[model samples]
Target: MFGNDVRLKLKMACRLLGGQKSVANSAHIDNSNFGKWLKGQPTLSEENIQAVLTAMGLPDGEPDTKNIHCWNIKNSFLNNLSSALSLYFPYTAEMARAPWVVQGPSLKDTLGIGDAPNTLYALTDGKTRAILRMPRSVIIQENNVLPVIKWRNDTPEKSVLLIEEIKSGWVTGVPTVKEFDLAWNAQGHQVTDHDVLQAIKDADISNKEAVRRIKQKK
Candidate 1:
């Protein structure tokens, strides 16, 4: 699924940017190799994924785990999250009044909930929407309220929740979402959670400095 999504996204990127030739040049992979890679032939290394994303002019850096609303996970994770979100926030004539979906991964990997490699998604009702994703393993057993508090207070951009599923004495993380101020902007500037996560991923800053800078901007 990852390979397939990458291929489709690459094709879309090519068309958006220019043509096949331009995409080939930007991705630094020959057309034949690119085709092979897309077919699950394993032509490119994992490192090349970043190259493809960069060529498409998407964000470049480590995947953010905090915002969960913008973290890119494996395709399987995304599919599951999308299904769960649609279920939780079912679309109806009244709900369909708004017609846009903002999908992405979160900033933190496991919002202290169940396991690693959890993906996130956000859906809005024009004013605000929910931010949801799976949590880490340790978080599944401990008190969940702390992460919830952190998510609410520290993440001024939205209100969110951490979710986990425990069954038969075993815990499994699942996609979670909660209300957030989708239209809110910091410092009178419109910055999506993706933008903030990207900045955090790309910038080289200490914990103290990072906090100071983010606050200063706000």
Candidate 2:
């Protein structure tokens, strides 16, 4: 059986893309086989799981690499802020033992959350939640344990999201995260559904038609 988290996301993806048939077509799976995977009739193989996720166009679940010194785009965005901006990080297998906390404006601001002694946060833009994680070792805050953050308005160049310029840094994934960001410049998107591409899938309808349907009701 698929994990509840994966199944739930599958359900949402299917809903957004039109239906199971659409998702199956996008994943290049026969409709019947995809249905079986959904129902767990024979269960889904790991290889197929990756294929489905790839079709979903999500950031790959595995970090591009484990080298902590490497740079990451998503992590670069959280610098010089003051509030909570929790990015959902992946948990290999031990996540089963940890709790899931969803962050909102009241929680803080930004994305690309770093490591913690205990829990990891889940971040969603009402469509999909991108989980995240970064080693605490690479994080250097202005004060202490937490990552550094700044308001770009205070000093356009100083409050930048560049890691080299960060008073401190965080984790990363998905270069497209800014497109959906609701904070700061909101440079990602502020109107309409930002995930239209991922949502269109293989609906067999014109992309324009699908968008019309969504916008009319959206």
Candidate 3:
């Protein structure tokens, strides 16, 4: 029986994780039931709560990942490329080589005394380190060689207006999208966030079942 605050978190989890169906599947609950329960149809259940939280990338016993943030640009663009590639080739699972990354507890938060101060990061691709915040983007910069759009040089003014809100460019020429596509086709994501979440849920369920069995035997 979680309150509105917890309920709101469940909703936010859905947004971050794509949607209700995605969350429901990972939690191993029916989509409709999951929606209703979070909506307070009959209130929340502890079992379902744990499943959902773990599916949303929270560790066991943790209330939520309010402080943790995770992202992967390759996945974001590859998802787009998947949509694009599907239009041309008969797409398969192998065609998609992206992982939904989930960040764990921060050392600063877990080990530090009080509130963590704001900090700017100059990240790296193991070779280059740069800080490119793009003025307003939440993503300061990922120093990896990634896609870029010469949106202004050759692309039409009408097209620029179409993607006006998109914050692209600053990487003059890294790796071409074509090369990225080729490499993506050659390899598949070994394990994905979905796999991790499902494994966490499965392990949790297995542990509980084992405990129940031991109790029954006793």
Candidate 4:
């Protein structure tokens, strides 16, 4: 599924950037290797994937694009659909669990979004995790004057949930407790439930109501 998703995205990237040759040149990847990727003659590498995204002027992140086949944006601030299309990327599942910084094209002038911040953090929790649980791509949009993310369901019913972005980027998916523990330990702070809750509060990615609900669930 990941391969197919990469192929699908690669084809689309090539089209948007011009063609296979253009992509190869822009990404600085060898033409033969690029062709091999298209033909499935060899396995796709992280390096090539990053190169493709770089050529496309998208953020460089380890987004699991393979699990996602389609993405649909609703009520986007950007007037140009093509420009909005560049917003989609396969973020790693772990990155999805917490807020992380991502750099991309300045979205300010494009739709009055504002200037590129010296640093910006993406929120990757709550509804973003729910969507990934369904194993689908997310739809990016704005709600209540904040960036909201939701699952892009491809079914006929098209059930979706729109939640505010963790900060800006949505989580790729949930992470295991062990992974969470490792992350906490790596932070070099004494681990405690209070500490974890405090960290979440400091991040400001999860809504107060949502956080309250989560605590209640626990």
Each candidate structure's TM-score, on Cα atoms with residue i matched to residue i, is 0.27, 0.30, 0.31, 0.28
Instruction: Tell me the whole-model lDDT of each prediction, alpha carbons only.
Output: 0.38, 0.38, 0.38, 0.40
On residues 1-218, what C-alpha lDDT tens digit does candidate 4 reach at each position? 33654565556545434567887898888877877777666645778867776665543633333222222222223333232232343231112222221212334423435433122112223212212211112222323112233222222122212223342323443334333333323423336988867777887757676578678999
Better of 1 and 2 by TM-score: 2
Question: For candidate 2, lDDT tens digit of each residue in 111-207?
Answer: 4355332122223323333333433222223232133222222322222222211212222333244432332233233234555565667566778
lDDT of candidate 1 vs native?
A: 0.38
Stretches off by above 4 angstroms in model 1 are 59-218
Report residue 129 deviation for candidate 4 (angstroms).
23
RMSD list, candidates in order: 20.6, 21.2, 26.2, 14.5
lDDT of 3 by residue, 43-139 (tens): 4467877787777655353423132222122122122322221211122211111121112234443354454222212122212222112111122
Candidate 1's residue-wise lDDT over 1-218, tens digit each? 35565555445334434445565687787777766775668777766756765554443532222222222222222212322222222341011111111123433432433343333333343322333333321111112222212222233233232222222111223232222232222113356988766787788666677789878998
Candidate 3 ranges with C-alpha deviation above 4 Å: 60-218
Q: Model 2 scores what on Cα lDDT?
A: 0.38
Following a full C-alpha superposition, what root-mean-square deviation does model 3 have from the true structure? 26.2
